[model samples]
Target: NPRDYKSYKLLFGNEKFYDRSSNITLNYEYFYSCIDNMNISIDQLMSSIQKLQFMVVNLNSPDDDPQLIFESLNSTGVALTDADKIRNFLLMNENLPEQNKYFQNYWQPLEENTHFEVSKFFRYFLTIKNAQFPKISNVYDEFKTTYNNLDFDKQNLFEDINDFSNTYKMILECNTGTKKIDVILNRFLELNVTVIRPFIMAIINDFVSNKIVEEEAIKIVELVEKYIARRIITKTPSNALNKVIATLYRDFRQFQDKHNNQYKDSEVIIFLLLKKQGSGRVPTDEELIRNFKHNDWYNINSSYRSYIFERLENHNHIESLSIYEGLKNKDYSIEHIMPQKLSSDWKNELGNNYQRIHENYVNSLGNLTITGYNSKYSNRSFQDKQNMEKGFKESHFVNLNKLPARSDKWGEAEIIERTNQLITSALEIWDFPESTIHEMIEEKEMYIYDGNETFSNYKIHGFTFINDEYIPVKTWKGLFVELFKLLAKIDLNPLIECTKIDTKIGFESAIFSEKTDDTE
Candidate 1:
């Protein structure tokens, strides 16, 4: 066997066996050394391999679920992906000719267009249809269920999936061939907001289908950007955003119905997002400005911080400079005008409360600027930083201009003044959407829940709690349970205390006792 070197080479002569990038040669060498060290010759190795038994499975009937059988196999082979299973589920049931047709026409091309991200494609694809995110592990199950529910033939359904996947590919690549749309898409990607993809995909689909024009599509993307940007600036929790965004298309449809289908699609989206209450509300300009003044702009996430400054610096410029590229090439960095670690000259300029001033204003907006030469300005005094080459005085950035002229000294006062100026610029860059609801409102009456309400033949349309928009409810008990659920989420102890029998609070029986079997 050792003498037959040519045959041996032919047997294991695949290029991957020796290719460095493949890492196959390293593993193969180790395996060969182990075989030699164990006194196992080529004959013994071949004999051992021949003795190994593989359990083969075959369905007794053609109707048996190949997907189930494939899943049930316990072979120590490479595990199948959700996309693989879904593909098998769809095609395994068909005849060989049909399978080949579907694979060639739909499945293969879908995978290729998504760059082989069919699993994620299915998850986001179903999220738009189902109005909720399906767990990655449950994607195949979710797909099967939805596929069964819809009155779609295999060809039509595959076409739909392929169509949506094309748009999704555009979003993932950030190359929609439209500069305005692509810019916004890049911003979303930089923000690392994968949650908004389904919503964006739905919007793009509408545009291509002629349901909305290119202008309206761009407007919707901008609206989404404002909603997300304001929330980020205000430090809102993003946990509930998935549900809100996933349901936007559905909500827009409902809004259209209520308005006798007269409102534009963009208007309905704005209405729904603006009407949200609590943590999900589209932050007002006042809130954004207040937060902008106090936010630790330097320590914010790098992407968000860059996005903020880039928007400000290039705002309304005839030719915008690439702040992202400059930062990448080390041509620019976030410069602290007052310097992070103060020099003695800077200390003297800041005065008696220097430590307090440095601690408070060091990372805030006014104290920060982008400079091409950050190392040269390290801990320099106010006048040196202002008057040096490529300094505040020499910089062309709108943010840095007029900063030297603001005052001769850098201190708490100057930072506050600069922050006020930047806040004015920010207001222009990320302005809140103005509401035109009065012109669009119908003559329908709405109700708000109050404690003293009595059920005297009053039919429930919907109710609003605190700042929450109109939430539709069917029965009085549904409203009561929902209110208590919201209260319990805030603090269960308050509700638990109320559940106990207490004459002082005018409770005769336990209202919400867990032990009680009464449905009421």
Candidate 2:
């Protein structure tokens, strides 16, 4: 028996002599045996038999093209799926792990270099898709580092990645046979810590993909609103959460405005929450109103807060009225007469250092007071507003400054003079109580410096040969006369007003005129 086994093995050792004809014969015999002995139907037997034959053929024919093998297998009436074929082919290779690594490394660069085109690498990855898993820990580490390093302006990067992760998680939930709602909710809670509204929207969008029908999306949004409300009630309130909600409400409102649509259900809930709480709900609104009503006028009915919200809403600067109630107190309601949002011309005149002044002085209620005509005074300069108010005979009740205007164009000397006037007026308003107004005035005076001679070059230079008794040199009269000559050269009228000159230089000053030649 041992001799017979050795003789049989030696006879079959000539693998080069084995051909496709012999392989097919072997496969046919195996299929017949499966059909007869396994009690399976001929189709089932044939289906089960082909995959084994494919593996054998692939193994024996070392130089056989993979594409040809795939095509042949596909053409055959076989039950083995594409995934199964790939798995089997990978299992047959001794260096499968090394080959996979080589393919992944090679393909990554090619795909990235080609701008992520659907190339051979992409196809290969798809073929061996199950073998690849994301390095979530590494990804999260990088995300945390990047998030921590981001400046305020660059915060959107973390937001985008968070959104993508949320989307991926939603997909995983659908396919994975597990209920990990807690994990997902925790992730959402962490995301809420970051004020990134767009990322939240992206997550919502992804979650509501093809799985959610149109009507169901509406239901889902309602559920999300409820969830947000519940979380606000249970969780510790965060400013970041409030900002995210505010931003989302704003974006939704913009969408509604542009499309001429009504506010969505979720947006309405968010708006309600914003109005009720500065950021998120703490105690219920009823409890808050009841507790604060007796003493807190600001908390009870925030008139000033409502006014700001109304103004912002009217201007379309903010889409929704979320902070309407939060800003409602006497202390908070003062509107800045010199609004922080300055015009381009004003900003240019005020050096970049003006930001500090704006934050400290302009944004404060002391510098802000309710105006009867907020829209009309919106972008008007302080001087312009003063003129308008005076002409209208309106009481400038909230006096942030007594000066006629705040001007960036003014030099340090001019600023000091204005500051002195403002302080005097402020003292008068405060009933001239023993105040530090004088000290503040003195401090502003310290900023003043003597004018440099460099400014002299900017002045017009002129000389006038008048009657020999009076030789004028660069005086106002001589300058005007020279200016008239320049205008005359340009064919412009050289009309001079004796009254204007008298008003400017005094009536006692000599008045001179050159008679015009009508023909010339």
The candidate that wins on lDDT is 1
Instruction: Give one digit per residue, the lDDT tens place, for model 1 in 169-195.
Output: 888887767777888898898788888
Estimate the lDDT of model 2. 0.38
- Which candidate number has the best TM-score? 1
lDDT of 2 by residue, 125-180 (tens): 22121112113223222333443565653224323333333443443233212233
List where candidate 2 sits over 4 angstroms from the true fold: 1-203, 206-208, 211-311, 314-335, 338-383, 386-520
Q: List TM-scores for all candidates, in order.
A: 0.78, 0.20
Q: Which residue pairs show backbone clashes in model 2?
A: 302-328, 305-327
> After superposition on all CA atoms, what RMSD does each candidate show versus the true structure?
7.4, 31.1
> Residue 119 lDDT in model 1?
92
For each candidate, the alpha-carbon lDDT, in order, equals: 0.77, 0.38
Positional deviation of 416 in candidate 1, in angstroms? 1.4
